[model samples]
Target: MATEDLMRKALEALGEVNGPMSIEVIHRLVDAGDVEDPMSIAEVSDLLDVSAHTLRYYEKIGLVTVDRDSSGHRVYGPESVRRLVFLTRMRISGMAIRDLQHYVELVDAGEGTVPE
Candidate 1:
């Protein structure tokens, strides 16, 4: 599916929910369709409306970790795509890269950090 379509679906899902939006909620919404097949960098870039260079920069800075295919092409799984969705949204909301990095660190630290 196209990134725009997925994003549209996520937004529609978001509209059905109440209360504050959390990472878990967003994840569920984005993962509702759950693309099982891995996607290429260009595909992801088009989906997130960001350039390939931006995606590379995000990976370079440790914001996300994408796997590599046999031919050495970047392969983005559902988790990575979901992370990109959150990251891109946060970025659009004015969260700094350092703050986002810290946030990701906290998230990776454990589920206990959710309340932090």
Candidate 2:
């Protein structure tokens, strides 16, 4: 798929997710661009089909908070990206939110261990 077309699909995926977008959107966002750092909330949501509101809830309870952009939008750097991926996996595995928050705090603290 084309780059722009992919981005649109990503935006749709991470968006309200009111409905499903084409599978191409998932494909493109997953590998589009040379994003060295993690994606913004919008970007992650688009790529991962997550709701920013859910992400925000994670942040609210200290699940994640790498930083924010100049516009005060949640800015998830590369580390955040990796953590989100892990979080998503855990969620899929049926981990509870409280447990996820604790795991996130450990990551923010540079533990990078345990939860095994």
Candidate 3:
């Protein structure tokens, strides 16, 4: 599927949720539709309405981890896109950087942090 189509499906699914959607939920939404392949950094930036600089900054700050293809160009898969969506929404909602960082650390730490 086209990148735009994939994003559309994800947004449609996102709108159906009553409350905050977790990473798992977002994953399910993205997985519901098949993407032909991973998207490039520029494509992801356009889709998320974020700048390439901001996307790089997110990776630099550990907010997100972007995997590179064989040619060393950044490739954003569905999971990475979902993460960017979540991060962008949080920022728009006024979530502090420190808190977002902490939350990301908690998430990286695993499910145990969910109960804390």
Candidate 4:
């Protein structure tokens, strides 16, 4: 899918939330299956409407994990792209960074947090 399209869907996914919603946005976007081949950092950055520095920051904070190519350039795979989209949507929804970190922590914890 095109970057713009991905971004649009990401924004759209936020509508399912009224307020203080859970992380269903991630599952919704991920299950949408917009996975394309792995994309470069610039490409994913442009798609997500974020800067490279911001992407690096996301990684630094463990909000996302981007794989590196042989040359060490960050390559965003499909899962990573989906995650970035979700994270972008969450940020746009005014979710606090710490809250997002907690959400990520919950997600990383897997099915146990589903009841949260």
lDDT: which candidate is best?
1
Q: Alpha-carbon error at 93 in model 2, in Å?
A: 0.6
Residue 45 shift from truth in candidate 2, angstroms: 0.3
* Superposed Cα deviation of residue 110, candidate 3 (Å): 0.5
The lDDT-based order of candidates, best leading, equals 1, 4, 3, 2
Q: Taking the tens digit of each residue's C-alpha lDDT, what string does model 2 give over 8-102?
A: 65556667234444455345434543457657788888765679887787767776666877887778887666666667656744599888876
What's the C-alpha lDDT at position 34 in model 2?
41
List the candidate 4 regions with Cα displacement exceeding 4 Å: 1-33
Candidate 4 pairs with clashing backbones: none
Give all candidates' CA lDDT scores. 0.78, 0.66, 0.74, 0.76
Scored against the true structure, residue 67 in model 1 reaches a CA lDDT of 99
Model 1 stretches with alpha carbons more than 4 Å out: 1-33
TM-score of each: 0.69, 0.59, 0.68, 0.71
Winner of 1 and 2 under TM-score:
1
Clashes of 2: 4
- 2 or 4: which has the higher lDDT? 4
**What digit string (tens of lDDT, one per residue) describes model 4 on residues 1-82?**
9765665565558663443333444345444348689998888766665689988998999999999989999989989988
Question: Ten residues in a row with the worst lDDT in model 4?
Answer: 16-25
